[model samples]
Target: MTTASDDQKLASWRAFLLTYNTIMRRMEQEMQDEQDLPLTWYDILAHLDSAHRGALRMQELAESVLLSRSGLTRLVDRMERAGLVERHPCEEDRRGTYAVITNRGEETLFQAMPGHINSINQHFLQYLDVFDAQALLRVLTKVLEGERPAEGSQAEVIEGDQ
Candidate 1:
């Protein structure tokens, strides 16, 4: 039992997936070519920079960056060697480690930010009119808040409130 609305919804979902993959690849390639830095590294640096006192617990960072704990640990090891980040044993919680951004990390992020902003503007923002932008934001916010795309759907959206 196919319906026009269901077909349209599936088409929209496909479009979203395609656009996301395309934009991410472009962002990654541009970052690597221009800065000699991987997009994953940039993402970690940016997340760390935004955290309180430029630090976050390893688990929190893993969640923030959408990386598994083991994966993040390996990446953080590399970053530490590069002087981009440092791991400090938490005073209050000895078992927890905090990933803190270094001055060098901030410098790197600051340098990369302008190009990133330009890329986002060029590839994404320019396509959205004000109304479209607002609508997009609202819909995304709702989705992030565990909203169902269709009424009567019982699916759960898994997202942490960061």
Candidate 2:
């Protein structure tokens, strides 16, 4: 039988999942209505736009966008067909491939930015005060860092790091 603490933790997890889903759905609808862009496509474009030379290796892009390799491959194929991105063979490694954002992709990203920011502000950020935002960020960062493997930790490791 689950104890009271376990029950409370489960409830909290469920609440977090529900809130995440609700916010994502609202943001997706807002983007679809206002910008005609899906959140997933925007996420991929945003990552590419921020990367050096507006490009990233396929594996890195998959990790950045939290998609499986096969899933990312299919999505990239679609984006390429849509004229939003292009695939370039890596000069360093013949086997490696890079996804480079096209001029059209950059234009689309710029066009979608305002609506995305507005949706975020309206659906999420408006609810947070400075302190709440900071606390939430800190807690989420800690959780994410903790989830990383010690061998390949993403956060910096100090002398006394756990």
Best by TM-score: 2
- Supply candidate 2's per-residue lDDT for 66: 88
Off by over 4 Å in 1: 147-162
| lDDT: worst 10-residue window of model 2 | 153-162
For candidate 1, which ten residues in a row score worst on lDDT? 153-162
Task: Candidate 2: give the clashing pairs.
Answer: none
lDDT (C-alpha, whole model) for all candidates:
0.87, 0.89
Give the TM-score of each candidate: 0.88, 0.89
| Predicted structure with the largest lDDT when compared to the true one | 2
lDDT of 1: 0.87
